[model samples]
Target: MAVKDAAKDEDDDNEVSAEPTPPLPTPATPPPSPTQEHIPSSPQAQTAQP
Candidate 1:
């Protein structure tokens, strides 16, 4: 009976001494780019001919 109790105590100590598992790191994501066309000519830039 004493030996059984000693083994149980040793098992409990081992369980307490075991290290915890670490969490996994999250993955990184890339940013989106803008896509727009620019018009260089304005209404004043146009000329009328007779």
Candidate 2:
């Protein structure tokens, strides 16, 4: 019975790990820059709204 219970527990863990969690947008977000790239310092740089 102990062995069976252990096997069942392992199976449950495997199923949880196998679940496909939604992809996070964290990676898509650009890293912080010392100088904001979107700032219209030049004629070409357009002002972007957050």
lDDT on C-alpha atoms for all candidate structures: 0.45, 0.58
Candidate 1 lDDT by residue in tens digits, 1-50: 99999999998887766533122121211111111111223333453221
Error of 2 at 5 (Å): 0.1
Clashes of each: 0, 0
TM-score of each: 0.37, 0.39
The residue ranges of model 1 lying beyond 4 angstroms of the native Cα positions read 20-50
Q: Put down candidate 2 lDDT per residue, 1-50, tens digits, no spaces.
A: 99999999999988776663323344435543423553435435443332
Q: What is the RMSD of candidate 1?
A: 18.5
User: Model 1: how far is 31 from its true place, Å?
Assistant: 33
lDDT of 2: 0.58
TM-score of 1: 0.37
